[model samples]
Target: MIITLPTILSIIRLFAGFLILLGFLLLARPAADILAFVVFVSAAITDFIDGYIARKFNLVSELGKILDSIADKILVIMAWIIIITYYEFNSWIILPIGLIIFRELFISGLREYLASKSLSLQVTFIAKLKTTLQMVTISLTFFSGIIVDGSGSLTTFLLQPVAGSGTTLMEMACIVLIWLSAIQTIYSGWEYFKTALGLMGTKNDG
Candidate 1:
């Protein structure tokens, strides 16, 4: 518990997740949605900053790693759930989100089990790409909602996709990114599981 700068930043990101949740709950007010958006974006930015600061200044620590992971899950999963609750969507959106959730939980368990045996499952570049894209998708969705709907009404995203061209294009890009993230999520999750299994001497051949 050295409480380094990166550790403090990670802690702030963790609390920002809850604040984002609070703002989303009060989305009846346009300002609340804005609040959530600001917090979400700020948290995402801090995520990058903390990682850079930790590496550059050698502030990385076990506590910081654990806290950063937990904060990421909270922020991403919470935002996904709120998006689902607010917007209307088809399987194109819902299915991807489902896959993302499943991947997160399953991979987290795999990591824990491996850790118990003093094993490490390294993260792949594609997995990092998936996470970044997912966050970007979430950010764009909230921004589009604010600009397209403009009143913070909690209904009608995909339900009324006939909004102007700019917003519609933005919505389409979000949908594409969601599916891409899901595909990478499954791929990365499988890779991690395979690596973990090998570490445990139970590597799957199929």
Candidate 2:
């Protein structure tokens, strides 16, 4: 089996996800954090580009599909775990993470079963939208820490201590986005399960 550029890009994205996870856990130098952010963002862009190029250039392959799915799951799960670690370990993150992980496992199993039976499940537009929201929310949350570093005039203005300020407004905005993403995650998971179940039932009837 020949390795293609898309497959290689997927691997890079997976590795970058692990790097981001490590950066979150280690809390190393600020410089290292910035580097991790750069790598993660670049990998994410490649993820989009790889799929686009693969489809556009008629280069899609089984290995590319597998690697792309693996890359996406690793990046999302790692991002959720890292967010929870940084945000004081709330159960809210855990709920969405569990739903997302379980849904991925369940859907993957269903897909394999269907494939064995010579059937295919179609991806829906809502699923794509859910993914887009999740990616944006996670990326924002990942870089939200920089808002407190006093880098820009806006950051300094926003970070200014109120009479009894404990948390910055920017941090609050990140939290809101994270929660909204979680809601989308749950909705998407439910939607996926419904679609899968319907497909399975139709296959069995056929």
Candidate 3:
């Protein structure tokens, strides 16, 4: 595939995911948190921009589709992985994040299998919704985990003075969003599975 603006943005997002992961890992320091936040938010913005550009410019190719999905997965999945790791493997954090991650991998494998057969799993509305929600949730989780304070001025982002209760509230909100996204993830995964089964001539009765 010829290189295009959308493809370039997708590539940027894919690389940004790793940088965000590294930055978040050292988020205890202000500089690292700022770095993570900048890269994370920029990547999140590009996710929408690239897709829009592709559709608008008739630049949507098979490679673009594949890269977009892969980039989305890498960004959010790795963020969640690192989050739970930072949480020291807490069950509460792991349950939702793990479910989301598992569904992503399962759906991804199905996509690969379909690809091998010269087929593709078109992304469903629910699948897109899950990714958007997951991104927002993860972004907020990062913000609260690093920044925010008690007075509820609701100042955003990391590492330059934050206090109690308000920060907890923000974290709680992030958790709720994560679980919501996880539920959507499962539903979307099932939708994809049904499509895959139909493609394989097996009726998904369940």
Top candidate when judged by TM-score against the true structure: 2
Model 2 has a clash total of 0
CA shift at 198, candidate 1, in angstroms?
1.7
Model 1 TM-score, all chains together:
0.84
Q: What is the C-alpha RMSD, rounded to one decimal, of candidate 3?
A: 4.4
Please give the lDDT score for candidate 3.
0.78
Tens digits of per-residue lDDT for model 2, 75-123: 8777777777666776766666666666666777877877888777777
Against the true structure, what is every candidate's RMSD? 4.8, 2.5, 4.4
Which candidate has the highest lDDT of all? Answer: 1
Off by over 4 Å in 1: 27-29, 89-91, 149-167, 202-206
Candidate 3: lDDT of 146?
55
Listed per model in order, the count of residue pairs whose N, CA or C atoms clash below 3 Å is 0, 0, 1
Span of 10 residues, lowest total lDDT, candidate 1: 151-160
lDDT (Cα, tens digit) per residue for candidate 3, span 104-206: 8998898888888777777778877887888787777766655643333454433333365333455566667878988998999999998898887743332
The C-alpha TM-scores of every prediction are 0.84, 0.86, 0.84
Model 3 worst lDDT window (10 residues): 152-161
- Please give, for residues 81-196, the per-residue lDDT of candidate 1 as tens digits: 77775446556567888989999988888888888877778868878887788778888777766665553444354434545643355567667777777888888888888777
Ordered by TM-score, highest first, the candidates read 2, 1, 3
| Worst 10 contiguous positions by lDDT, candidate 2 | 28-37
Kindly state the number of residue pairs that clash in model 3. Answer: 1
